[model samples]
Target: MHRPLPTFRVNGAAIRTIRMSAGLSTSETAERAGISRRYLNHLENGYRDRMRPGRYAALRTALGLNPDDQRLLARLPHEEPD
Candidate 1:
């Protein structure tokens, strides 16, 4: 049996706040996170509410989130494997 994929519910506003506080631009953060700027923009604008666990972790790392902030932003759930 395949393991379920980890899904994360992200907080767009919180991400934008953290990025702005860190003095990082969308392009910079996206580059650091290895995601496209448009995708990051979608995330920041709340267009996308769900993300894979790996992507969420990369975004958190790119934003340099503190432990508390990371915990606040991360909500992971498992999805059944196809």
Candidate 2:
């Protein structure tokens, strides 16, 4: 059977964490990442799916995230450990 494609369900907490680490306002980050402030807010609120790849790359890069973080952001959020 074909393998399933990985989902893109970035957790809002992760987004907020990275943003805070970078000491960036949502508007500033959104502008730098080439996304709208409204869209970024939605992403941070966990109400959106599938961020634009370029924009996602921009956010991760601007946040100074390493490869693992980049990889993690590209996939769906993990379930809480049971």
Candidate 3:
């Protein structure tokens, strides 16, 4: 049997925590991350589960995540579709 590819999930709580700790408003964060405010809201609210790699990289860079934060973000659990 062929193994399924691992799909990574976005940890909204982590993103929200980082945004709050950085004292950034949703608009500010979204602008810095090069994404729309609506999308950011979805991510922060846990409505969205996955993100493109480029977007993820932009988000990480925008948030100025440290090594630990990056690791935590990477470790977020993902759900595999049936």
Candidate 4:
């Protein structure tokens, strides 16, 4: 059985939540995330299944999330410490 990549989400609840909350255009986020606009689009639409750490770092920083929030976002389905 193949496991889904931690970054690839069927529903994209996390990605969409961050994007919406930041009020950033897809193009803007893509640039900040250090990915192509198309890649970011795919990630946002749940069309792609993986995001690299570099992209993750950029996105987290651009969104102004703290280290903990970034970890939570990076972990996805995994729960963080209370």
RMSD of each: 6.8, 4.3, 5.9, 5.3
Better of 1 and 2 by lDDT: 1
Instruction: Mark the regions of model 1 whose C-alpha exceeds 4 Å error after superposition.
Output: 1-4, 66-68, 71-82
Candidate 2 lDDT over 1-82, as tens digits, reads: 9986544556677888878877999999888877888988888887785665566677777667764675325343474544
| Candidate ranking (lDDT, best to worst) | 1, 3, 2, 4
* Per-prediction TM-score: 0.76, 0.70, 0.73, 0.64
How do all the candidates rank in terms of TM-score, highest first? 1, 3, 2, 4
Superior candidate under lDDT, 2 versus 4: 2
How well does candidate 4 match the true structure, expressed as C-alpha RMSD? 5.3
Candidate 4 ranges beyond 4 A from true positions: 1-11, 70-82
Give the Cα RMSD of candidate 2: 4.3
Q: For model 1, how does the per-residue alpha-carbon lDDT over 1-82 read when each residue is reduced to its tens digit?
A: 9997877777788788888999999999999999999999998898987789788878888888744565425344553244
Local distance difference test, per candidate?
A: 0.81, 0.71, 0.77, 0.64
Clashes of 4: 0
For model 3, how does the per-residue alpha-carbon lDDT over 1-82 read when each residue is reduced to its tens digit?
A: 9986554567788888888898998899899989999998998887886787778878888888853455325352353234
lDDT value for model 1: 0.81
Relative to the true structure, candidate 3 reaches a TM of 0.73
**What residue pairs clash in candidate 4, if any at all?**
none
Best by TM-score: 1
